[model samples]
Structures are given as structure tokens and as C-alpha cells.
Target: MPIERLADLANPATTPRIVFKVGSALLFGAGGVPDREWLASLVAEIAAAHARGQQVIIVSSGAIALGSARLGFAKGGRGSLADAQASAAVGQIALAGLWSDLLATHGIVAAQLLLTLEDLEDRRRYLNASATLGRLLQAGAVPVINENDSVATQEIRFGDNDRLAARVAQAASAQAVVLLSDVDGLYDRHPSEPGASLLEQVKGVTADVHAMASGTSGSGMGSGGMTSKLQAAEIATRAGITLAIANGTHASPLARALGEEIGTLFTPVRRDGARKAWLGGRLRMKGLLVVDDGCARALARGGSLLASGIVEVEGDFRRGDPVIVRDQAGGQLAQGLSEYDAAEIDRIRGARSNQQEELLGYAPRSAVIHRDQLVLL
Candidate 1:
């Protein structure tokens, strides 16, 4: 189907869930003051999305910038990590209050979720974060997510909200991710260059797509540029989520997105279940599990990988690492997250599910890899 048809402006139910990324450049006005007018318009859009039964999640940026301003720093004047982190600390409180108060005016509850890369990358934390966001949507509250700048070291940060928004979409199983920025969409060349035209649709992020990203300037307010947005598109599309880059500085950006009138859309065929999609993504597979024919057959029928799979485990991997499941002949069958680390799996190989605890000297977890976490490759 054409990407525009999915917009279904008259009835937003077609896109059940959307994650909008609001950058710092659009969040504040002159003198580091909050852009209440712009924010109010966005709050209205959120209310509209909810009334239409379209769940909304916001990955917003501005805490650090706001904090910087509150600290009496000039624009782009932060000279050290200490300065930036301190600014985020001061700004996050106001940011949360701003969202919560604005949303309250619409009778909507705003929930703040401050996260770092670790929150989404660790298995236990990932499950908790995803579940929390899902519950917020279910409870009719809008989740306002941002990078945990206060705690994140420079080397550990997402650096840009674009990728964070895409990851959040994956975590929450969102159907669409709209990156609202200073520019309308992707251009064939730098938009400033003559004949640099906006491309309406992108099938996938390719080498050519990366080339198009060069010289495309950002809002000069956010850390990300078109390059980061393209990275986001790759992440979102790989998980079967549609991503669009549009100019949020314009009036009613969501309306334009819903009307299919602006932005460069990147759409792909929907893939496996939410968790399965994560497993299928660009995770570095740490180990290979060789299962027997019976076990392989069971897996193909949507069954979880049992302890009795009688597999030969290759590689020393920790728990929660992605692993390739293979038949006895070493033919890859599927990919999944491993519940047990490699050593534990080796000890339990060929053992019954009930014997898992006996062999491991502890209560066993569920399947070696539960069906929900497995993706047939």
C-alpha cells in the first residue's frame, strides 16, 4: 500500500500508535524560554491523536539546553561535560513540569520517563521499560521520554533524540515514528544547493540514501542532523515501523503528517512480533545453538527452545545475548535471546526441562529462548 494511504487523516485508527520526536530547536524560543505557544499546539495535537484512538509517545529534547540557559550560559557556551550535565540536572525538573502542566490543561496526564542507552539495551531493563510505556498508553497517559542526560556519560549517551525515538518506538511496539525537526524532509542534495529536491518516499536507507544526507543542516538547536535521522530510519524500518522526517517548526505538523502533505516517508513490510523484531535487528549474535531435528521442528511450529534441544553450544556468551539457533547439521533455524549463558546451556544440553534446575543448581528460567523472543530467520 502507498505510505500516504496509511495516514488515514479522517480516521487515525489506521496508525494505531505514533512516536513523535520533538527536538530542542523547536522546544525553546529566544532567551531559553519555553515555547509555550508551540508546545500548546503540540499538546492539542496529542489530545487529538488520543481522541482518535491513536496512542502517542513523545521523545523530546530540551532539558540540557534549557538547563544551560537557566545556568546563565550563553547559547552554545557549554565548555565542559560538567557544565552540560549540570544544566540537564537543572532543566529536567522544569521540563517535566512544563509537559505535565501543559498536558493537564487538556485533561491529559503526562508521565515522565528519563532513560539512558543502558535502559533499552539491558534485557531486564528493556523488558521493564517496554512494559511501563505500554501501561502508560493503556492508562491513557502520554509518556514524555528523554535521554537521561544527568547520569549518562558522553561515551554512553544516545547523542541524538532521533535514534532514541526510534529505539523507543521499537520498545513500545509503535507503528510509526515521526521526527519533527527544522527541515521538511530528505533532499536529493543539500536543500540549500540548487535543484536539491525533497524526496517524497524512501524504500529503505541505502548507500545512496546516506549520500543524500551530506550537507543537510539540522535546526542548529538539536544535536542531530539528517545523518542521525537516516540512522533512525534504518533502525525503525528494520523493525517494520514507518518513520517520517518533517518540519515541526511549521504549524500543525502532525496534521500535515496525517494529511500526507509533507515529509519524506520510509516504509517497509511489517515483520515479526514486537519482541521478535528486536531479536531480528542488528544485534551481534554471540553464540550458536545446534538443535536436534525434533527440537527444530518444534521451534518452526512456534514452540520455545527447550532445554532438551540437545544442542551443541558454540561461543562463550552471556545471558541475554542474541544467539543463532541451528539444526544438527548447523543449518541456521532461527535467532533468539538466550536465557542462560553459554556455560549453563552446555551443562543442560540434552537434559529435560525439569532437569534444568537440577543441572544448573538453581531454579531454571523458562525456555532456553522463549518463543516471544525468537525470530525465524
Candidate 2:
């Protein structure tokens, strides 16, 4: 959908699309309940952005905490898996209701989506979710996403919303992401430690940056910390998306941070295309496809990896699996989505397109890794 207008209220650098991530600590105000007044201010900011034709998506935490409060127990409850799930189950309702009501105050609808880590890992499911978020924005609804803790097993959960927010930014093709937590931004060390200083702008998330990270939040309601925010920066930067770590405890967090640049901003590294960003952002690789020097040259020229150029297919990868492209010297060159399974690629490796169908006894698809599916490393 086309943006109808643009204004200063929207984030100047990334106005068209942005994701705002609110952590539980900020959502859980005094007395273990949502600070309705604070939330109302944030919602008003969102409404203003919507009016400016800046699409906004929210990744919010606090369901489990809300649920725990409703269960009339400590947020941890018994600290068991069942207890956690029960809290999330009850809290999701209240949390969703709160968001709906707050957003509805401005005639905006809040569309809730609960996603597990597995959903973003699978291509089919990821595409489905990406499309759904797009449609929601076109329909003028703000997408309020949260990790699917209610039914997700520990193995399939995100554990923290920081990285989840980055994944949602990638999925939504957001131009920027703002992580709203208790602290204003990332510090050189634990914020309370003597001499600790806030880093205003991070060019990249390096080892030194990781060294600066602190542990999980001291606030009992939160799971993410500076370490996870750095991890999130790594994910978002690769996708060419700008990310900010900002304080959300007060009202109008977006206006304060985005307008005043009052946060730690991580800039984008590449801006070629969203598809390439997705490939660059992907963390999983099913296998490696080693190519001849000729194939490597072709890939550099923006050509696909035809079977004829493949010298080796390593791993038991299935069709459409993500794989790294390597040169003859074992130097990583690119990563792409493989069109053929490992067994099939092995059979057809070094074979020209004409010979592919003859050897496999079936008509073959195009490139082993199409150019559109590949990104230079």
C-alpha cells in the first residue's frame, strides 16, 4: 500500500516501516500491572505515525507477567513449565485486550499474532507470516506480535523478545526497529558499575561490543538484556534494518528516542534488496556447495549456481534448504537457497543442464541455487 502522507512525527530516517518492541519490564509498571497512562501515550504516538502513513508494527512482551498477576501469584509462580504456560495463557488474553482497547481509542485495530521460533525458521511459514503482516498494515491495523509462549515448547521458544523483535523486523521488511526496555541504551558495562558509559551509536556489533553486554534484566519481569540487544543488532543490521535500544519506561518513548536520537542506534550494513537481506540474515545452513573457479566467477557476475559448476555437495540437505557457497580453496563466497536436495545435487554435480534430466530420468528445475535466492557473503 502506498503511504498517503509523510510528516515529522514519523521517524525521519525510517518512517515508512518500523517495528517497536516493548519489553515486559516497561509494560509491567508499578504494582505489577500495566501503566495505562504510559501506554496511552505510546498508543497516541503510534496513532500519529499511522496518520502520517508510516506503517508501524509492535512486538510486545508482558503476557506471561500479566497472566501471572491474574493467577494471583508471583510472576514466576511455581517456576515450572506448566506454571509458565498457564501464566502466558491467561496473560495473553488480558495483554491483547489492553492493546486492543488502547489502540482502539484512536480508531486503530490491533491485530495480534503469536509466533514460535520455528515459524520464522521455516521458509513456507515465514513467507506466510510476512504476507499476513503486510496485509494487516494495508488494512490499517497495527500488528502486535509476541512470542508464542502459551503453547510453544522450550526448545521452540525465543527465550527473549530482543532477538524476536529483530526477526519480526526482518519478516515485516521493516526499515527500523526500536527496542524499548528499562535502560536508555547500551552501556560500556553494567549501567550501575562505576565508570560505565552509554554508547550513543554503534557502527557494528563486534566482539568488543559483545564484551560490553550485561546479563539478563534485573527486573523480574524481563528476560532480555544488553547481550540479547546486541544479538538483535547483528540480525537486524545484516537485513539492512536500523535498530535502536531505547528506554520505554516513560511516555512517548518513540518521540523521545526517534526525534531526539536518544538511544543507541545500530546502522544497516547492506541495502541491496530485501531478498538478499533475508539470505544474509539467515543463521542456519543445511550444507555447503563447493563450486569450481568458473562457477565462483559466474556467481560474482550475478549468475546462479548451475549444477555444471558444482564440484561438491556436502550435507544431507533437503530441497529448498539454505546452503553456503564455497570456492575450490574452501573459501566462503555466498549463501543461497538450494533448489535441489543433497542426494539429487550429488547425482547431477558437474553435469550440464542438458545432461541433468537424462541422468535423473526426470525433467529438472533451473539453477541449483538461483541468483535471486543467493547473497554474497
Candidate 3:
């Protein structure tokens, strides 16, 4: 089936899983404090979705803003990474408290999740995080997700929650990712440019489509610029998750984004199988297994990776580690749990299955990576 139109997309009745990315501008009102009126309405919207059996997750960005005020820093002022980290630590408590309290008024429970990039990269951590979020939804609680700014360095920091929200959508297998920002939607040119117009529905994020995005980070209250949001759109749409960019300043922005057709909608490809879905997301693999063209073809045909097909193994990883399968040309083919250790695969690369016993101490029970464990990309 083709993707739905804006009218259908806005109707909360259609989407099952919705990830709402709330920027600092929406969370902090003009006075730089938590906006209870806006937040209350937003919770009401989420409660309505919950009553209808729809799962809602919040990817919020307000810890730094809230923390800065608590720590006596100027609003929207620049600070060192250490300062920012301290602010996040202070603000996270207040932010979580506000969410919990406001959500309680609507008879909904709020669960705070602080995540670092490493959590989403490591296979074990990724699975654990996803399971925890999933359980919260099952129990009718909303997971309020935020980056672990307190400990993050430049290398590990997501910089903006825009891309992080996209990763969350993929991990949760959410149907749609709604980025509620200061702007209403993407425009043909910079909104400041005279005669610029909004692009209602974006079919593909081509170079031209990306060109439509402005470089300016929306408001001083937030860190993410339009560029990050577009980058996020690319990630989510490719993962079979629809994305919408809309204004979040008003009440119940989630419902408005889904029901008004006012935001820019990025269509998604058809969802893949469970295995493929797991592999396609922004997961961190422990190593790489470069294979020959024949192996890539076999994988495409649903075949397991044989030792004979491996050209090389890069990185030192243990058995049961998540590894990426790439072709000799350095293109990714699949990702799976490796049955053999790095040293073992290094010794068995390009060797026939029958020769494993003579080459190594013991013969393996199955292929290097079984079909069940592999996900072709």
C-alpha cells in the first residue's frame, strides 16, 4: 500500500506507536521556566492516545535549560561542556519531577530514561534499553527519554535530540516520529527569505529536499538546527518510520501534528522483517566481517554466512558479539551475532566447513553466522 496522505497521518486513530520530540522552546515558556499550560495540554493529548491503546514516548530536550536557571546561569547562554553536564544533572531531576507530576494529574505514569550513545550502540545495551521502554508502554506508562548530557563528551554526545529521537523511533519500531520544534515545517527556502513557502509533504529526502533545510538552529532555547532535523528525517524514513516536523509551541502539539496536516511529512518505505528491522537501526556492532560477492548473493537469498565466504574479520570481538557483514568492496550486507570469536574467524577465513576440525581444535555446530541470527540489509 502507498503512504497515507496528510489528513490520514494526523488522525491519531491511524498510528499505533508515536514518538514525540519536544524541544526546549516548547518545554520552557518565555520566562525560561517549565510551561505547565503547554505541558498539561500535551499530557492530555497523550492520555487520549493512551485511552485508545496508542503507545506514546517522549524524547524531551529541556534539562540544560532548566538546569542553567537552577544553577544561576544566564538563559540561552553558552557554557563549557563540564558546565553543561552539571546543569543537566541538576535539571534532569527537576524535568523528571515536572513530567511525573503533570502526567499524574491525567492519571498517567511517567518513566524517565537517561541514555548515552553507548547504550544504543552496544548490542546488549540496545536490547536492554528497548526492552525497558517496551515494558513501560505495556504497563500504560510513558517513557520520557533524554540524552545523558551529564556524562557525555563531544565524541559521545548526540549534540541534539533530533537524531537521538530518530534512533528511539527505530529501536521502539514506532510508526511515526513527530519532531515538535519552533518552526511549523520545512520550507522551499529559508523562512527568512522572501517568498519562501512550506513544503507540505516530502516524498523523498533527495539533495534538493535537503537543500530546502536551513542551517540556522531554530531558537536559542534549543541546540538542534533544521539540518539535524533533516538528518533525523533521513534516518527515520529509511527505517520504515514516517517523520513529521511541526510547530510545538501550542497546546497538544502531538495531536495537532497527527491531525492537522500542517507539518511537513516524510514518507517511509515498507517495514522489513523483524531481523531486518533490528539490523537496520542505529545499532553499534562490535566488529566487521568482510565477505566476497558470492557470500553477499547467498545472504540475499537467505543463506547463512559460511567460513569459506569470509574475506576478513576486523576488530577484536568475542562470540555472541554483534558484527557487521560487509562485501569486499566495503559495502554493508548484513549484521548478526557471530558464532565464532575474532581469533577463531581470523584462522577460518576462506576455509571450507569440512576443514574446520583440522584447522581448529573443534568443528563448529553451525555456520559462522546462522541464518536465524543474520539480518540482511
Candidate 4:
């Protein structure tokens, strides 16, 4: 199908679930904090979609902008990491309040969900987050999600909400992810330069897109640019979610993009199950697990790994590190984070958790690798 046709199909009028990401540059002007009139119009468009019975989840970026204003920092200050984190702490409340008040005006109830990379990285937490968001959609509530910046260290941060939005779209099985940015759409060259032309439709994210992108221009409100947007497009497309990069400066940009009258649409190459997509597209992994023959066969047959099947555990991976699930023959069957540490798994292997204390003097929860946590390749 043509990219525009795919985009038309993914519109809220045709599709049930949709995820929208609003960038900081679009949310706030050159100054900090949200533009009230702009936000009101944006909320109204989202409310219109809700009235049409389509589920919408918003991944918003503006906490730092709000925080910078609150802290009296200039837009392009060379603040330390701690300074940025502090600003997020102060700005989160003001940001949520804006959404709450704006949505309330349209008779739409909005809920705030603050997430860290850790939340999506751990299987149990990932399932919980997915279920919660799904329930909100079912209940006709729009979930406004943001990275938990106040507490998240550099090690656990999503870096920018564009990528976080893609992860949310995967979690929701969203038909599309609309990225609202300052620029209208992807351009053949830097939009700032003369003669740069906007590309209306992308068949898929290609090397050309990557080559054309430039990193953040030190605008300082948030740390994302054309490059990050393209990275986000790749993430969303590979997960089978269509993505549109549109200018959020215009009020109701999302509505315009959905109508296929505005923005650059990037068509998806393929789609996968929500959980499977999340598992496959993780940014990094923490450890490795080597299993025996029986485990490999069971996994191939769509069965879960049992404690009796594991042979060796490598590295100092904690309970939630993304581990390579390898067979005794050294072939990989799947990749999942272990639910237990290397030491714990080593002690509990080939035996039930109930038998742990009897053999090793201590017992933890059963099932070193829970079925829900395992994503087969």
C-alpha cells in the first residue's frame, strides 16, 4: 500500500488505538512553559478523537521547559545534569496540571503516568504498565505519559520522549504514532537552509533519512532533533506502527496529520505483537543465560523454560537485566531479562524454589524464568 493510504487507514476514525508525542519545542515557545492557547486547541483535537471512540494516549515533553522557567534559567543555559533533573522535578506538577485542566474543559478525563526506562525494561513492570494503559483506554480515559525525570539517573533515562513515545505505541498496539515537532515534517535537507524540500511520504525509514538528520541544535528546552525524530520513526515503523512527523506549532496538528492533509508520513514495514515488539527493540541488554537442549526444544514449541532446563548463568546480571536465552549448543532461542540474579539462578537450577533452603540454606520465589517474562524469538 502507498504510505499515505497506510496513514489514512491508521487514523483515529479508522483505527482504535493511537499514540501522540508532543515535543518540547512545539509545546513551549522560545520561552519556557506551555503555550496555553496552543495546549487548549491540542486538547480539543484529542477530545474530538475521544468522542469518535478512538483510544488516545499522549506522550508529552515539557517538564524541563516548565522547570527551566520555574527555576529562572535561560533557555540555553549550560546547566549540569543535576540542574536538569531538578528542573524536571519542579516542572512535572505544572505540566500535569496543564493537561488536567485543559482536558477537563473538554469533558475528558486525563490521567498522568510517570515512567522510567526501568519500568519498561522489567517484564513484570512492563506488563503492569501495559495493562494500566489498556484499562485507561477501555475506560475512555486518555493517559498522558512522561519520563519520570525527577528520579531517573542518566543510566536509566530514556534521554528523550520521542523514543519513549515509540515504546508507548508498541505497548498500546497503537496503529500510529504522531510526533509533533517544531518542524512541519522531514526535509531533504536542513529545513533552516534555503531550498530544502519537505518529503510528504516515506515508504520506510532508510539510510538517507538517517544521513539527512542532524543532532539537537542546542535549543536547550529538550534534547531531541531531526535525528532523534528519525530514530523514533524507525522504532515505531519496525514495531508495525505507522508514524507521522508534523509541526505542532499549528494548533490541532494531530487532527490534521490524521486526516492525511498535513505532515510527513512514514509507513510501517511490518507489525508484531506488542510485548514481542518491546522485547525485540530494547536499547541495551545486561546479561546472558545459557540453557540446555530440552529448554531449546520447549521454547521452539512455544513452551516456557522451566528451572530444570537451565545449564549455566554468566555475568552479574540482576533480576531485570536483559539476558540472552541461549541453548546448550550456543544457539539463541530467545532474549529475556532474568527474574533472579545469577547467584540465585545458579543455586535454584535443576530444583524447585521449595527445595532451595533444604539444599542451599535459602529460598526465593519460584520460577527463575516466568512464562510472562519470556519472549520467544
Candidate 5:
């Protein structure tokens, strides 16, 4: 779609599959409890979209903030991971209850979904989570998603929901993602600087904008800084999903963005189907296979990775695990689920199919990785 058309469709009123992300700063103040009036109004706008037949998914951040308030701790104490986890345990319930109660006022049901990065990295777990969210959307229930902070260690945490929201948009095949932050939009320079101008529409987030962005979060409580938001934009745009960064200070901010008058719009690079986008972008590879030059050419021309073409296998990956197929020069050519285990692949490397039984006493399938299971990078 053209940039102008994307702008037109992103207007909060017309978006079909809309994914809105709410940062912690917007949901709470110094006291840490939610601003009920502001949250209520935000729910009203989402309910309006639902009434208009638009499918909406909300990625919210505020569990830690709410948890701090409920636990009677200061917002900034340099707490350990255990402290943060404790807060999340207390705040998650309040967060979900608030959303459910507010949404119920408009006769819309809200369902809570907690996820960790691990869920998106594993193919089977990813599919199961996707199917559950899909069913909620199909049943007309608004799904509110958050990172599983309680159980997620620092290594596995999403850190911020901005990136998670982008991944979710790809998983849900959403048309656009709305990032509601404390600031209005992307500026040529820091908004606090003199003569800084707001960039209305960005064809692409260039390196210059990225350089200008400081690693500063507008709200002290949120983890996503301007740089992280830019990172999220890159991820969403590359997956062919439009992204809008706007101010969440006011109620009905999404409605304003939908009007195409209030946000920094990042246009899509290339649109991809839902499953393809998820498979190509979200699934984490478990292993790698190095191929010869001839096999590289065939793969570049849209061929599969056959046993005869493979030179070596690396990593202890099992069958059906996502693996990267690289050339001898270390250039990634494709990604796919492997049909053979690493040990089996090592034995069958460079061997023809007919010689498989003679060498190994058993032949798995002919192809090492089938074409249908592979995605050319």
C-alpha cells in the first residue's frame, strides 16, 4: 500500500486489526495507582472501535507500577529481580480486574494473556498461544496481553512491551500497531531541545533518526525509551505492519491517531501474510547447517536443502526444530525446520539418498529440509 493510503487506514476509526500498546508511565502517576478516569476513557475508545467491528488487542504495561503501590514500596528503590517479581504478582490481578471492570461497562469482555519471550521462541508454544488469541478474537473477546513478569527471569523478559507488541502484531497479522507513550511523537531532536520539530510521517526510520534518539524513557516507570520505540517500529514495519507512536496523556489518543492528525507514522516496508510473517520473523532458530556453493545457488533460486548439498551441521538440534541454512561463506540463505537430527545429518552429509540405507542402515525422508518448511531469507 502507498504511504498516503496507509495513513488513511491508520486513522483510529478505520483500522481493522489494531494492536495498541500502553506504557506504564501513561497508566500511573507518582502515587503508583492507576488513573481511573484516564484508563476508563481509553477503554471507551477501544470499545468504540469494537462497536465499529474492528478487532483490537491491547498490550499493556503497569503491573510493576501497580504492584509497587499495593506493596507499599517506593517506585524507585533499585530493587532486585525478586522484588520486581513480587510486585508483578500483586499488580497483575489489579491490572486485569481494572480492565475487565472498565470494559464491562461498555458491554465488552476483556481476557488477560500473559507471555514470556520463550513463548514466541518455541514453535509449538508460539502456535498454541496464537491459536488461543485467535479464538478470543473470533469469539469477540478483547484480549489484553502483558509479559509474564512474575515467572520470567531477567534473561527471558521482553524488557518492554513495545517490542512484544510488534511481535504480537506480526503473530496476529495486525494491519497496524499503535504505541501510546508519554511523548507526542518522534522529533527531529529531543523534544526538550529548542526548535525541535515533530516528524509527521516517516517513510522509513532512517539511521539519522535512530542516531538522534536518546536512550531515555519519557516516564520514569517505563522501560521502553525512544530508542526502543524506534526498534519496535523497525520490527513492525519490516513485517509489513504500519506503526504509529503517539501521546497517551489524553484520553482517546488512538481515536486521534486514526484521524491521521496526531502521531509519528512509520509506513510498512512490505506486507506479509500472518503465518509467513510469524514463521519468518518470530520463530527462533535452534541450529545451523552449512551448505556448499552449488547448493547455495539452488537455494537462492528457491530450492530446498537436500542431503547432498549439506556440508556440515552445528548445534544439538532435533527434528522439527527451526534451523538456519547458511552457505560456506556464512551468509544465511534460508530458515526452516530440520527433518533430521544433528547426528543423523552429520552422517548423511553430502550423501545421496540411495546411499542413505547403505551408510546408516535406515533412510529418513529424502530431503534434509523440505521446500515447504523453508523460508528464503
Candidate 6:
């Protein structure tokens, strides 16, 4: 199908569960105050989506900008980590208040979710977050997610909400993710540069696609530029979610981005099952389990990783953590959520299924990493 057809918001088929990544630059006006008129228009677009039975999730930025204004910090005066933290602490209140009030006027309840990178990395926390967001959606509430900047140290920060938005879409299994930007779409060169051209459709985010983005970050009000949006596009599309980078300056930006060909559209590959998406999309592994040739062949044939097959357990990880499955030759073949903790797996290494009960006093599962939870690399 032509990628442009998916941009039509009027086509219900193009949208089911949609995630909108709102930029700080678009949320705040001069002096870092809330741009109420602009926000109202965005809310109207969201309300229209609701009317059509489409669920919306907003991964918004601007807490730091709003908080800095409230704390009397001069524009661009976010000097230290502490200063940014203070600003986020103050700005989150204003950001939530604005969203709550605007969404309320349209009869939509706003639910706030403050997350850290750890929330998505830990398997247990990942499930908790998914359940919470799912319930909020089921109850007809719009989830307004943001990184917990108030407590996030420089090392822990998502850096920009663009990537966070993609992770959120993946976690929620959203069908589409829209990144609202100052410009309409990706360009062959900086839009300000002579002879630049817009790209309306992208099948994948290749290195050439990334090269098209400007080196500079976005407006001072936001940290993410077209570069981060491309990173986000890569994450979303890989997880089978379509992504759009569109201009948010318009009166009904969401509606316009959806219904018109006013932005760059990224098409997703065929989606796998939930387990596959989670297993395949994880960027970090908590541990590694090396197995013999027999087990490697079993995994290649879509079989589980049995405890008896494991030769060595490397890394400190609790049960249910993501672990890489490697062969004795040191080649990675798959990854999955482990059914046993690292210590337990160490004790049960090279043990048969029946021997698990004898070694651990009880056997909860025969497979160290079940086939249902595994994804081949």
C-alpha cells in the first residue's frame, strides 16, 4: 500500500491505538508559558480521535521549560543538573495541570505516568507499566507519559522524549506513533539550506535517512531534533508501529497529520507476537546463558532452552530477566526472559528436567527459558 494512505487520519484502518510525541517547543510559548490556544487545538484533535474510537497516548516534553519559568530562571539558564532537576520538579506541575484542564474540557481524563529507563529495562517493572497503561486506556483515559526528570540523573535520563515515546509505543503495543515537530517532515538537507527537499515516505530509517537530519538539536525549548525523531522512527517501525513526523504549529495538528500528506510517514514491517516484539526489541541483556551444540540446534528448531543444556550462566540477574542464549562457540542465537535466577541456574547447570526438583527442592518449570518466551536473533 502507498505509505501516504496511512497518513489519512480519516481512515480508521490507519489508526487504532495512536501515540503522539509532543515536543516542548510546541507546548510552551515566549517566556516558557503554556501556549493555551495551541494546546486547546491539539486537545480538539485528540477529542476527535476519541470520537472515532481511537485511543491516544501522549508522550509529552516541556516540564523543564515550564518549571524553569515558574522558578524565575532566565531562558537558557538551565546551567547544572540540579537546576534542570529543580525546573522539572516545578514544571511537571504546570505541564500536568495544562493537560488535565484541557483534556477535562473535552471530557477526557488525563493520567500521568513518570518513568525511568529502568522501568522498561527490568522485566518485572515492564509488566507493571504495561498493565497500568492498559488499564488507563481501557477506562477511557489518555496517558500523559514523561521521563522522571526530577529524579533522573544524567546517566539515567532518556536524554529526549522521542526515544521514550517509541519505547512507550512498543510497551503499549500501539499501532502508530506521531512525532509533532516544528517542521513538516524529513528533508534531504536542512530546510533552511538552499535546495532542500522534503521526504514524504520512508520504508526504513537507513543511514542515509539519518544523514538527512540536521546536526543541531531542536529549538532551545526542546532537546530532540530530527535526529532523535529518526532514532524513534527506527524503534517504532522495528516493533511494527508506523511513525509520522509532522508539523505541530497548525490549528489541528493531529488531525492534519493524520488526514493529510503533510509529514514524513514511516511504514512498519509485519508485526510479530507480543513475546517476539519484547524479546527482539530489547537493547540490553541482563545475563547470558551458553549451551552446547545440541541445545543450539534445539533453539534453532524453535525449542526451549532446557536447564540440562546450559553449560554456563554469566551475569548477576534475577529470574524473569532478559538473557542472551549463546552457543558454546560464543555465538548468540536467541534471547528470552529466564525462568530461573542466575544463581539458581548456576546450581542447576547441566541438570536434567527430573533432577531440577531434586536440586531446587521443587521444579516450577522444566525449561530454563521456555520457547514461548524466546526469540531467535
Q: Which candidate's TM-score is highest?
A: 5
Summarize candidate 2's per-residue lDDT along 28-134 as a digit string, tens digits: 76555888888899999989888878898999998888888888766454387888888889988899999999999999989999998778877778889999999
TM-score of 5: 0.78
Question: lDDT of all the models against the reference?
Answer: 0.82, 0.83, 0.82, 0.77, 0.82, 0.84
- Candidate 6: pairs in clash: 9-258, 9-259, 67-91
1-377: candidate 4 lDDT, tens digit per residue: 33355346344565678888887777787568468888888888888878877799999988877887888876432277777777888888999988999999988888999999988876678888989998998888899999988888778888888889988887777788888887778889888889999888887777777787778733556678888888788778877888888877776776665564567888877665666678765755677777778778887787766667778877888887777788877765677657777887787677755676776666555556665666654
lDDT at position 126, candidate 5: 78
Against the hidden reference, what TM-scores do the models get?
0.75, 0.77, 0.76, 0.75, 0.78, 0.77
> Cα lDDT for residue 374, model 4?
66
RMSD of each: 6.4, 4.9, 4.2, 6.3, 4.1, 5.0
**Candidate 3: tens digits of C-alpha lDDT, residues 1-377:** 33476555434567778898998988897645888988989888877877777789999999988888888776443478877888899999999999899888889999999999888866678788888988988898999999999998888767889989988887887888889888789999988899989888887577788788776676677888888898888778767888889888777776666676678988875566544555555546789999999999999999999999999889999998889999988877788888989999999889997888888888665798998888765
| Backbone clash numbers for all candidates listed | 0, 0, 2, 0, 2, 3
Ten residues in a row with the worst lDDT in model 2?
Answer: 1-10
State the weakest 10-residue window (summed lDDT) of model 5: 1-10
TM-score of 4: 0.75
C-alpha lDDT (0 to 100) for residue 227 of candidate 6: 87
lDDT (Cα, 0-100) at 207 in candidate 2: 80
Model 2: lDDT to the true structure: 0.83
Which parts of model 3 are misplaced by more than 4 Å? 1-3, 9-13, 29-32, 35-41, 47-53, 73-81, 104-107, 117-140, 152-160, 170-173, 184-240, 249-256, 273-276, 328-330, 354-361, 364-366
Ten-residue stretch with the least lDDT total in model 6 = 1-10
Name every residue pair that clashes in candidate 3: 10-258, 10-259
- lDDT computed for candidate 6: 0.84
Off by over 4 Å in 2: 1-9, 12-14, 73-78, 283-319, 323-377
Q: Can you give the lDDT of residue 58 in candidate 4?
A: 93
Q: Report the C-alpha displacement of residue 166, candidate 5, in angstroms.
A: 2.5
Residues 270-303 of candidate 6: C-alpha lDDT, one tens digit per residue: 5667667766666568899999999999999989
